[model samples]
Target: MFKTDHRLMGEKEANNSRKNVQMQEINKRPRINLPALRDFLSQFPGKFQRHLKSRFKRPTETEGANRDIFKLKDANFSLEKQMQAWKKNPVWDDDQPPSIEVVVPEGSLCQVNVKTKVGLPPDAVYNIVTDPDNRRVFKNIKEVLSRKVLLDEGSRQIVELEQAAIWRFLWWSGTISVHVLVDQNREDYSMKFKQVKAGFMKRFEGSWRVEPILLDEKLCHPFKPKTLSEYMSCTQCNGRIASKVTLQQLVEPAIVPPPPISWYLRGITARTVEVLINDLVEEAARIKGVSATDLVTTNLNLDQALSNEIQTLDIKERWALRRRNSRVKERKDRF
Candidate 1:
């Protein structure tokens, strides 16, 4: 009887231990609230669609109306005449200098207009601007990562480009990746660009116009005798050309800042326009066989000053160094 009771007690203890182990295993497993989880998952798709819709919405009616003002109906005829006049004569006022105008017509929508003169022929200037491979000339551009021709026919070509650009605002500075579609019209000497995807921009589009100024002798009755003589007897009378370039851009940032920050950004935009025009002028001079020293001094004091300011901003050093390093790496790889 004693042996049987002892065996029964041992059995009872073993069963209790097994029950405890089972309870502990159950405790270790995570208890999920399935209904709450299902509700969250069900809501995710709708929220994601709404978010995407907001970011990628088409341009508003107001923006479309503003853009309509810049559209050209008969581009070929008008551009041809403009080109002929420029090739025939040069017309420029010594008093009028390059200028940039910025207008904010609506919320976060900014328009910038740049008017500048270059000593190169309109055709040369146009060629430089339209060449996708030549984007390294622009100060803000770090690199032209890739360029793919989508459509190419006689005087018109559509290209897609990927570029890296450095953007600086006071103490803030970073690089931006940009994907753009460029429609180039060689006949019109015009190029239009729109950003398809970019890191920091919501929408960016721009147009470039290269106009040659050929003044009719009959229209210069009001100028002084000396001025008239200089204008008429200038070296640019026969294909020695001067080009008037107009750049118009509309841009909106991905995220809008406060009023003070917005003002600061606008100032940066204006300065950027100045730098770009100066770079173009320098490029034109270079094409005409002008020396770098002459290019720097000839009415380019503002450009020099701006260059100095940019250097102080610490943005140029980064990109310049990066480009140098990349060149070195490429050379090494080839070897």
Candidate 2:
């Protein structure tokens, strides 16, 4: 998840003055001899550059030692380990409609959750999603104009270069360039991406998540197993492990359009995600030699949908209900 910038204000003038004085004193110290250092490094010709390049290729961190934590990798929530303190909930049906919702309750930016069940191992699914060569699999991505590796750690790309992907919106019959910085991690099977130098959108960021799930109905309801390995190794389950993938994307445009155009914009975004999930599911089917699995997701706004059945209400009661709903949404989307 990504959030906007926030500025910290100093409450004490004394502290501000003290910080200014400290900064002034530090600036009085002699500056480093950058020209001399550059000259010395230049004398080594390509050796320094080669060493620098190789350094980036070395293993940067131990597995599971990353400071940045992924929420999807949380130990509980039926995805990983189990604790008696946590409540259990059943997974959604496989034939439901697309799963997309507003991440923030009041902001211009919106987040979409697209998920589906794939008849493949987690590693196999992970490889397909992270591989740029398979960009053609995503129908929305017309072409990956350019992709470069900015930094690599061992075999994984820690900080990747900007990848310019041309996306065509079928509704508008036009194309837009999406420039993104990808952070691919093989350790947790997650890929974090953020848009760079925005064009169509002012802000765009999200991640890809892959988790193993059992396909059996008896064992899936309430998800009896505590871990993926346990579910996959069950005797009655037949040693099958299907991957449950989730793609979360947050987008914000430079300017808000009127309701007429806004509806089309939302349609374009949701349609793109639909294509992405369908393509991934189809690919999984082809690889595993099985039928395409239907999406196993649920609507996020069921409560609101149910409330629409109310036949009548007072004007004051309606506004009060509106305020209650707004507060609930804000709480859900709060960072």
Candidate 3:
């Protein structure tokens, strides 16, 4: 019994010694010190957001505009200047057709440049194009299936929408659904759009820029605009501002067809642009002719409910995290 007790005491002492040695070795090891990095997202929130947004819009191929189109102000965002966006627009004459040119920027991709000078104000043309409910005016667009405002700044909005567009080839006709993300800015009188997912189009993106063009450019003393407006003031024109509107769109298909089909596709794209521009021109003329009260109360041959209709899926967290159905109200058509 004495021998066993003595051995147990010795084992305990051995374990204690081993533990003490391990503790000493651990204490002797050098520690790593990492420098503290500043969190710009938290510290400089505005700057960080601007940095992120800058990555979204790359400069257009041509050297048009300040590209500072995204610079927005809540109170002082003047539509008069629009940051020199229209300065380099092609001199579009009233009698000529809108300049439409197609360029293949990359493999099987077509980028279309459409520029036209409208007789109406930039704001008038801009309002017609930016309104989602105005699809009725566009001949090719059948309907907007769903529209969601992802981000809404006072002068700017980021919208995600699905559109059903009527398409025809030879004797056959069909409706194509397109999903796109649109960045609409009233400050710059511009809208930038890109396809969210690839379907009929492998890649699709575009920008619409509406800038003021004076009726008389020769009225100014110097090239510098004397007044607050971008277009120089004129006695003959009575501050009558026209719009130099430009649309640059790039569209590439999931599969490129042979010669005849490709040519047909190009024709379709051009005609679609023509329809859009024609719509804007006509709508502006109609508005300019009508009284303010008539303009406000006019039905515009449109469905009253379209402006308020929205349908979208709920956040994945509704089912994934809680294992319960979402509380969101869903339309029967969704099923």
Q: How much does each candidate deviate from the true structure in C-alpha RMSD?
A: 23.1, 21.7, 19.2
C-alpha lDDT values of all predictions = 0.66, 0.58, 0.64
Poorly placed runs, candidate 2 (over 4 Å): 1-98, 103-109, 159-171, 216-237, 291-335
All candidates: TM-score: 0.55, 0.53, 0.57
- Tens-digit per-residue lDDT, 1-335, candidate 3: 34468888999999999999999999999754433234543568888777888766564523222233323232332444432223333122457568989887756557889998776656767877888898867777889999999999888999998999887655578999989999999877999999999877899899999875555544553553333334333332233556789999888999877644565566667656766776666665455553323223334334222211210012233224334333232433376
Which window of 10 residues has the lowest lDDT sum in candidate 1? 63-72
Window of ten residues with lowest summed lDDT in model 2: 83-92
Clashes in each model (backbone N, CA, C under 3 Å)? Answer: 0, 0, 0
Ranking by lDDT: 1, 3, 2
Better of 2 and 3 by TM-score: 3
TM-score of 1: 0.55
By TM-score, the better pick of 1 and 2 is: 1
Candidate 2, 126: how far from true, in Å?
0.8
Q: Please report how far candidate 3 places residue 58 from its true position, in Å.
A: 24
Best by lDDT: 1
RMSD of 1: 23.1
Off by over 4 Å in 3: 1-93, 217-224, 229-237, 290-335
